[model samples]
Target: MEVTSPPPSLLLSDSDLEDCYDIIDPPLTTSNDGSTVSEDIHKSMDEFDRLINLDRARRKMALLNEETEKEEEKK
Candidate 1:
């Protein structure tokens, strides 16, 4: 698959980015209220985290591959 870097201006707004961060690193809650979090919410959050991790890893690998190819061409 071809991976292209996004333009800087295409990035999410600060507020939206913060929301994502909050979901990935939720605040510590001491309340054990039954209505705290539903099973579906937990599942969705987990799925989002997995997707984010996979995307990050793929980007990193693409960058490394680019660097490797450049080095090989220089050899």
Candidate 2:
């Protein structure tokens, strides 16, 4: 026996959609489990900064490599 999938409209109910949105865009909380919130925020910010710097460095390296390749092609 073969089974067919449910229609897109019937796949997710209104409540399910709201739950998905809640997961995607959660409300920010100032304080949760005591003063650890600040520490968590600081750690996350540091991680974000590190990722941004890494991405910038990667772009610079890619551009430098492209320029080097072009110079080699000219020779």
Candidate 3:
């Protein structure tokens, strides 16, 4: 059987590597169907913020309840 050589990237020079960036890391662009992409991203961000705030509030309430319990125990 014949031996095949390695791919072009393995043999690339520094300048060649720089020029190959388009192939390596292509540009990211949302499709132009509608405002759905931006709206979806915004919706996701809002949901994430809401969840984070909810968690923080729960933790604060728990701490407050613990303090109240300790104060009652001391009385």
lDDT per residue, candidate 1, 1-75, as tens digits? 999999988889999989998899876554565433455578789999999999999999999999999999999
Please report, in order, the local distance difference test score of every candidate based on alpha carbons.
0.84, 0.85, 0.83
What is candidate 2's CA lDDT for residue 12?
Answer: 89
Query: Which residue window of length 10 is worst by lDDT in model 3?
Result: 27-36
**Model 3, runs deviating above 4 Å:** 1-35
Write candidate 3's Cα lDDT for 12-58 as tens digits.
Answer: 88878787985787544465755555567887899999999999999
Model 1: lDDT of residue 75 = 100
| Candidate 2 similarity to native, TM-score | 0.54
Worst 10 residues of 1 by lDDT: 29-38
Decide which is better by lDDT, 2 or 3.
Answer: 2
lDDT-superior candidate, 1 or 3: 1
Q: Evaluate model 3: give its lDDT.
A: 0.83
